[model samples]
Target: MDKDARDFINEYIASLPWLTIIESVNDTLVEDNYVGKIVIQSFKGDVEIMITIPQDFPLKGIQFMCIGITGYPHLMPNGLLCLNVAPAGNLAGELQEHFSKLRTWMMDYYESGKQDAHFEYYIFDADPKITFVFEEDGQKTRPAHCCGRFSYTSLRQQEISDERVWLVTGIGDTPSRFSATFMSFHQPTYEGLYFLLSRPPMINVNQGLTEYEDLLLLLTEEQKGYFFSTAASISIRSGYQTGCIVIVGYEIPSLQSGLQELRWEPFFISLQEYPLKRDPITDEIIVRPSSVSRIHWCKGINASYERMFGRGRLCSELTSSKILVMGVGAVGSQLAHSLVRGGCRYIDISDSDKIEPGNICRSAYTFVKTDIPKVQELFNQLVGISPHLEMQFNIAIEPILDSNKGYEKLKMYFSKYDFIFDCTTNKHLSIMLDGMQLPGRIINLSISNMARHMVVITGVSQIHVLKNRIYNKISPDKREPFYPETGCWSPTFEASNSDIAAPLHYVINELNYRLEKQLIIASFMIVREEMNHSLAYELTYDL
Candidate 1:
């Protein structure tokens, strides 16, 4: 042990009058190895406390534990007393404050019998090697008992370690794959059973079931029949492994609104050993009468659309809106990503440009490979972000603009979407799209040379009117544009991702607000970044 840690421990032992140290650090039977532990009688009766100062000393707080108690509100199965307490200036003051907090925690446990009403969950003793992910909405009602199947895409090792990890995509009655246009869905999936109970099946107040026979006993007669019947009917394919997962769900009251929410706990079992056996008379396999197979409780990851994608509050319009982004360039790609991240499900992206090396600095395209189309790479990225996102990518929109009878095709195609955004910054294309006077709402989004301002023109469909408004409202670039390639004549604007993201986020927030409020009118909106780093929004209406 370090000299500082030893001095602190000596100081703590001498200062704390309330705690009587029964076993000192010199005792080998208690904790022999490291800085050693001081077992003290800090609480009322029968509950001993073990205090150990970490190597970092006062920098990292001390560790405390109840010697032999389990299944309390704040106590872990191994009797680790989990308390969040701040440290003091000196070791003496720190020890006193920690002991005070421990006393308070013990008092609360003894008096109220529960420390936190909202977070008190049953602890199951099982391995977390396998995990099952499912969707959960706080208020969604589910069947009392049902068989569910969930599809998983891949099993790969974690980056830092060789530990295997599984990613479950979609969960339903029949297994479904995560939809993606760019990626194939040929991965393996598993079928599982679920039971909904009034409350969690527990061995004690806070300890959950850990054995298959115990779980069967906890279930109702009807539920037990359902389990046996399903287990018996389960067919083990010739080459496949015989195993399945069982998820137990129960309602727990939320302390905030006093409403009940579903809590799910999964347990995996090998069918060859559990809920299945060979008959005594005939050598045929049958459902087992009783078995003491251990329940392998898995870690549950909530991968529901609402839980994963909902950014706190989601607008219904954004979720259901069919958005068409005209270009997947810098501004366009970021806008498309923002829309997807903000809960827009159905989006179509159109672009003719390939992802260049220079585009990586400002755009969302992370790949540096040559000749990959912008729409293609962007589609892959969006699919990675949200697999359930419904998106279609057109390699080039310029050809459709030039093809014979293309205007009619454009009109027909554009009419299918609810909102069309011209992020191409191509004046001719924007004018043509606006002049088409398509059924859907047309909004043109463009940024200034240095990302100083962003423009959004909504509701105007006339060619001349949109042209005049754009010429009048949009100003010339103050800073000069540079060519990305040495000899290439394509002069693009200069701005980092941070510079563009600030204004783009402002524009997106305003767009969502206007969309939700049904205030998307024939108006011009400008989002300008001030010298003070605050965004200033200006909205003007058409005459």
Candidate 2:
């Protein structure tokens, strides 16, 4: 031990005449910590204490516990006294206060007169907090669930061992609620019960307690035998794993009736082991016969989802939302992927183009998707992003205004999504789509003239209105626009995917924000001249 710890230990021994040193620096059990124990002599009874102090003396305080007692008022599983409050000071000054608190805990067991005292539960070495899942052959990952009741098989490890591993399998709503199939022979099976508790009594056993007689009355002799053999704690699965137990136990007005009448809280407890008594009449070990619910396999996928995204309503809403993408080209591909990551549940894609090798410089999908159609490739990509994602793909044969059949089909397709994105930059197609009545809100996304501009028209179906707004908000640059393609018959603006990806991502994120803020246009351009330096080549819409 360090000098500070030695000094404090010496000081403690000299100051307390009643205390007897059992082990000095009992380093074996608790690893690399000072966990020396002491015994105290008192009139009421002989009290055994386990003192744990940090190696650092004055900086940290001492932890005192009274062990080896049972019955009346709940005690911690480890036999450590739960101090509601103790003095907050250096150990030299507060050792007496720590001793005094231990004295109080010691008296709690004796002061109460038998049955009137609160019930005490035995503590186990395992993790008190538990979310029970079924261990099955095919679906080991899923949680064990039943709407009302279920049947299951089980696998148990050898008894009298320190390790406790119980597998509850084959759960479902069957056996007619009174099947004696498993009762014919004794097999290593799950004999556990499923009941709700008022509090998470994993550690604090006092707050939530269901009567032993009440629980016993509900089970049969076979079940009681199984329950007594297993860990004496409740296992909670379903939506309660991520701490719904606390709310159902102490809060939630709907559960107040259960608290007042049934006195059952939504928590858990464990009695280390139940000692089975032999039947006096028959020479066999006595066990009650009850078809208590045994978990077959757990269906924890949805419960896991709930635990992950249940924190906020907006996230859950986003995951359940349906989105339609009219184009899977340059900017459109980036937008679709962004929306998917934001928890969009379903995305319906429509595009006439295919992913070409040349489009690799700007589109989200890489060269591997080149030969395949853009809509189909994007659909496959989205499926890979989230295996649970629902997606659909369609080839846009003609623009909405070109043919009556095309317009009707497109209209029906648009109706299914909560939001729509018209990402095709074709002017004729945009005007045609604007003319057709949309079933939902449509957002048009595109980049203009050498990727110097990103255009997004929300709510308004008129392409003319978006054009007018862009002209009014954006400022004119002094330099003439530079067309990117020289060899092609119809030269198009050349912009790298990096230069466009940010703007496309920004547009999708802002679309999620709604049209509450004015759209700001930002673009980067290169000024070619006799000299390498020039005036500011970037423009933005101030509004």
Candidate 3:
């Protein structure tokens, strides 16, 4: 019977042009009462589709329709087939109209034979829900369920010492009544309770209660235990409303047991009216609302601010400040170390060069070995010294010249800083930084050739100094060249000379100038002069 049905379906398919587009067909017999059949079809327009079916002989004409088409109208999983033959829902009523058009589409696919095509399809009744179960670590348990109730009139009457006055106020206001109930099976600590209530979908604990009447009280130990062991309830009365209440409590184990035994568990119970139900085993009853709603408490300011400051100074003494270091070399390093020792936190360090062996003579990293990435190593070292310090290092100065790239990053880095430093010898970088319209004070330091001498400059912005008289006081021509050779002494001139030069000419010159007469010292003096001038200018400008 299966063989006859297969032959008939094959004939029917063969009669259609679409079926000719199919490249290969295969059938496999299974040992367990079933056969698997597959049809692989290659369409002309770079489209190929393979269809598989169980050989049950079509009870519903077709078991599965897997149509692969070229770029034309595209096959969709929905029965509303999109084909060039009919634009809409394949609504052609006549059998000839539908079959002829389908055959034509197949013929087109067979004839086109082009391969540059994309695939898109829609499947009807696709199950959107994920069916497979996946294992995940740390799944959160559901929050303990809770409800609340309060009666405004009953609460007011309870508060009243004079019945006539209470009646007058209650009748005059026609006060809206309120009640609240909360249930939990876990007895979270006081801290945990605050945390749970502080999160969204609950009350904002940060904003304390506005009215003195807003209060919370701990229910009796029996009531608390009753709430945690089972579903329990409470009854509350306020001026406005009354309803069922659920209560939760948290307990910390005694210090003798330590934190190992500390557990935060919740107990839940409901309260509707009158005397609350008591559990038999624990002998704990549901808490009355009046007993748990009259306590007045709030988070302290000092405690809140302490949480904000983390490991820093007392909240009252804390101030937003900045430290600027001009050069990121040895002396600057030592100075930074000193400042950190002095309790100055938050520093900005800048250097444009990778650590080199040549820099060892005077660099802070001289004792340290070579090949270490300097900025990061220095950062780690500084952080080790003072973990609270916020330090930033900028390795590139070119970006500073290219305003588009540099300004934004620099502005963000320096926006809230209180000080700036110029430890760099790169004239362009220094000048560019000095030229910036800064909100904080500027400090600069540089070492003469080697570590023989050092100079420090402190100044304010040019705008503050000049008072709009002239924006820039220092001219481009006045700025010192970065390289030693380009400075006052030219290497070319020294090289051209004979008797004055030695065998290792440049090295001898450097040693002679730096070591003998102390050229580095002299340069440091020059830097000191520049610093003095800068400080003078800042002072004058401030005036």
Candidate 4:
């Protein structure tokens, strides 16, 4: 470091009471040597402390570890301070700034008599939709483990400190994949998405017990050590009344490596004042003394789409296929849900209309929005099911269908998807798209009166040819399939979701194979099903 910088640090040290400079190599920050060390006698004793110049001083921040006390109240096992919660940040401040924190921490630690500090317990993750049933007389059980690392306990009080710990149950350590902060829950009966998860009470969070008597057992000594540690938080629904114990507590840090060279391990603790509190001054946390709290900990199952269906080959492949869906009414919206369930992650939905009172029974959105665009509504609905799903949608199907409204350039944009589904049943728009040299495979899907029969036409410019083949006419009535529902121009197809969905699903299964390797194959799918059901009659033609 610069000589002036070192000189400033030394001058500051001389002013500190009970703190004396033992030695300073001026050249090495010591005279004679280009590299040297600085030793200081502190409150601990003559051998009180030493700040390691890990690299050139001022050029690199100083690192310090007492040659004495190790772990809690004193220092970590490696003798270093635990300020680096995740990892020690590069210390760049002047000597006074860094050393002052060390001094205050050491003095407080000494005054407190090295009492044990508490941390929060981090459960790997849990499910949202399913309710874990807890028996009045606990019996069934499983095995799990509490992972590594330590935490700082100096600042918070004995009873109300906001520390964190963790437990991973089920098969093992959650396969070590990158996990998100939280998991959302969904259920068929529930009409909306939610984030609340409830599970059974722990059978045993008792000390010296290797496993949690609840659903799973903790495997390691680190976990066992943590089992003995107490955890405290404001009780929401504990005791025999709620049956479900909500181990609510303060905020926990992201799980990562412990401070520098020491591992803190997990533990159980008791609670006094509420663990979570917002401070007004330094906004720092203040906790009252509370004993260690203990109860059995359990890991909930993760039921995400990727976790549930990623093992299948078709599901794996389809997730990577980019599907562009135009007109998300009854058919398109249902198709989007099916695709997401089949692990189709990349998708785009576009619709020119909004949901209306009459469209509720057939559309995908379970709830009603006053005048929200159809695409945005479907986009948010799909994301609620699978957080990993990547999709985008728009409300410009009308503009793209009109030549004067920039329809000619729209084909270039639509051509990027691997498969394009036109559920709009718009004959003019389908015919216009047929004339373009699209990069993606275009499949024009339409269901006739009451959904008694349906047709899916694939390949560029084949919409007319397939219709001719299916209807047996060179030019059939352009509006032969639709009839007025409410007004002259507004025609509605009476097919129910199952009536249209069954045939569309079968065709999609075939297209999954046909769309591979840039194949230019043209085909037609014709199907007629029962009024009460589907899959009655189906045929495919390759032309």
Candidate 5:
């Protein structure tokens, strides 16, 4: 402890007449790097207790541990009390709050237990090597079936946190090549076994499982026979490239979800080669396996659709729809980012320019300079956002618009998508798109000078109506002047990324709402930021 902390502790202890310090001793027994202990008299009676302070005292806070107490649900093996106290604030106030809570806990402990309604026992302990990712578990009647044998794929691998992370492609016989269409499905070479138990595999409810034999107690006689035979068969056939994985699942009820979900704990075990003997009476082959090698546990991560995207936040239409975004400039790049984060996976981006240093200040372009085209760089960025994202990029939109047979080629290309977002502020392009008989819907998105107004025009081609709406709604007096990219004069609008992103958030949410409700109509809308620091929305037309 520092001088300030020591002085504060001394002054605080002097003020409490009922509290008396017995001794000060150095100790480091707990997991939180405890530095020292202060044995003090109990606030109520003659009993004594120790208050252990971690190395980073005020930062990590302090924990109270009884000297020789037992049978307390909140106490750990080192006698440390598991007090769910908030982070430490002002030193004087935090010390006062902690002692006050400790006294209350002591008072309630003697009267009755203080266990919460949603407490559960730990089944098995493990030192995780890799994070196992799995699909989302939707609303089901029971947890995933814990059959004896299972299969997993190691094709998709990533290095995360200094370890190799593998995804759990499937749990049972049928495996899905989720989003990765290029991968072909075949019989997985790696396999493992699992066991399901109604009760925890423990010698006692409170004690931890230490040995391999204790696990067999939780299994039935029939399960034991199947487990031994499977282990023997796998040990004989399996090579030593990778050890086997055994999963133990327990049906634990949680009050938050009000469902009995399966709590899974996985471990890496070795079933290399076991000895076989013949039974005397039945003349049957019996396989006896060796003891469990390592009891370390591996981490399991749920990357299911429900958990990745907030539950029900991603709509079916948005997820399944193929979107084409044109002109990856300031507004268009931000819109592409918003679409991907909102769960639009399949997107095609088109841009004809290169990313310059100036674009980084007001656009999604990174600081790293590259000789590649903007669409290629943007495609690389979007693919890194999520493993499920599928995208392609091209520099053909501008060329197609300028050609003599532009409408024919553009219509043929645009028909492949469900929605085409036009963020290019080119009037000629919008006019041309509006006149063409296109198959997909055209939605024009743009921001005015100083990001004072944002316009969104949706449904069957309404470029003329959008222009009329903008002309009638925005006043000439409220217009702002244009600014140059550098000292040289190249006319461009003046607005930082934040200036545009603030209103674009509302636009994306509104678009999601429209898609969810299937309200794809010819509509013109404008978002205006008032001088009074308030926002207003104008719905000019909806047909």
Candidate 6:
């Protein structure tokens, strides 16, 4: 016999409470040929296991039977244990290594007397989500060793008649393969409860498995009221060659009515092919990926989206409003793209600036003619993807004060719009629109720091209205004279002098830089505003 088989047998024998060695098999006497029956009569108050092993076992593996009702792998008909590790078909080959590990596990169970006992649990009532972080210290600092997020549901029973079930539909960054167990119970008697643990079949991708694949367990009303305490263990092995392991635990529902609680604790084991390192210049931590890293990262985007949002509610509130993008420049272009991908349908865009060679890096409409205005070019691009999209082009026109006839044009253009976006940094233009007191909300976006910085500010008339009411102060006049020194677009120009050029270099770069910064700020403001809207709706429901 191989050393591994001998070690397995020894470990299995050590775990049993009693072992009876049968002297002979089939009434034939063979040297060193004996059968052993090991029995675990009692474990942790209510579980038992029985095993029969033929000495010089024919298959070099032990055959075990579970007689009790509480432990895992509840025996089915035909004397086959429904163990997760013993699935049928090709997938069964994947468990060979785990089988070897289980042999050693029996020894560990004997030495330790029980499985790892540490657990951490979290219950998020507002979000109706439960999270478990299983670790030695309950900290989630290291991703390599940490179990990723696992979403769970909560069920409550009121006197076994009234029941409430809440499902956890969305989760972030969960593992590809997982399992679950459900324990349900009612009030008063906590000891007698029905429980069900299930390990579903593995869901595989084209060649690999999905990262968000998980098991769902269902329980009946009888199970909920009778089963008092439940425990679940989840193991996740990363598909990458690094082979990180994340183990988690969760306490099943308790019978007591007032406030049932569930929690999670996680454990992490690292399997790195190479050592991690820190960059000398950037001081950023980096881990070298094994050869299989690329394969794991090459999953389909559709699959990923399905895994994350398939069970969650669609964001209907986000779809109700239209997003108007005024400029298709660097910042406005990116914002429009992001908004479209985020599920906004109705978009209106405008930009007077023409497409130049330098605009390619910043603008989404890269296949435009050199002389086409950015707005017209971007409109064509957007319409190509969505033929019925609403769009307008007020290209090559500079915004001027109402006293100069430009205000009438601006008013006509903005009359039907829900929101006005200012992607241009021209102070004169901003001042003119601010003065007109446009009927709709105005969102101003700018960029700075080489396109990295952005600021977004929504100019709502409510603030002006509130200021007027509270302080009895008239809001400052919207129209202000452009200052020559501080203004981004200079007034000095000589149309007749063909040889003389305007201060183009300084103005263009500065305008782009400041707009980037303003756009960043605007992005934050928009997100906060949306979140506030969501909260307000939630509060209204509570009321």
Superior candidate under lDDT, 1 versus 6: 1
Summarize candidate 6's per-residue lDDT along 1-543 as a digit string, tens digits: 344544555554554344332221122323543333334332443223443434445433334554443222223322324334443232223224334444443445433445344321221111112122111112212223122333333323322432222222212242222111111111111110112222211231101112211211222333222211121112121212333222222333322333322222221223333223334787533333441222121101112222222344124332235556676666666655544444344677766777766556445656547877777666655544332234456664466767875568767766666566676656555666667677766766653322222334455433323222322322232435333355585432111111111111122233335444554212221111136445211101010
lDDT of 1 at 491: 86
TM-score of each: 0.79, 0.46, 0.29, 0.47, 0.70, 0.31
Ranking by lDDT: 1, 5, 2, 4, 6, 3
| Backbone N/Cα/C clashes per model | 0, 26, 59, 39, 4, 47
Candidate 4, residues 214-288: lDDT per residue as tens digits? 211322333333322322211222222212222211122222224211111222222332222224675433222
User: What is the per-residue lDDT of model 2 for residues 306-349, given as tens digits with 9 covering 90 to 100?
Assistant: 22223432344345767778878877888777766665656788
Q: State the lDDT at 252 in candidate 5.
A: 54
TM-score of 2: 0.46
Candidate 3 to truth, TM: 0.29
lDDT of each candidate versus the true structure:
0.65, 0.50, 0.35, 0.49, 0.63, 0.37
Which is the winner by TM-score between candidate 4 and candidate 5? 5
Model 1 residue-pair collision total: 0
Q: How far is candidate 5 from the true structure (C-alpha RMSD, Å)?
A: 6.4
At residue 238, candidate 2 shows an lDDT of 23
lDDT (tens digit, per residue) of candidate 3 on 317-386: 1123567665565555555555544345566666655566654554556535576656655665665454
RMSD of 6: 24.9
Pull out the clashing pairs in model 1: none
Model 3 vs truth, CA RMSD:
27.2
Off by over 4 Å in 2: 1-306, 312-321, 329-334, 337-343, 351-390, 395-400, 447-454, 464-543
Best to worst by TM-score, what's the order?
1, 5, 4, 2, 6, 3
Lowest lDDT block of 10, candidate 6: 493-502
Clashes of 5: 4
Q: RMSD for all candidates, in order, please.
A: 5.1, 12.8, 27.2, 23.4, 6.4, 24.9
lDDT of 5 by residue, 128-244 (tens): 555555543434233254456655555344344656445555445535334552123223555666677877655443444555555656766656666666765554333224466
- CA lDDT, candidate 6, residue 426: 61
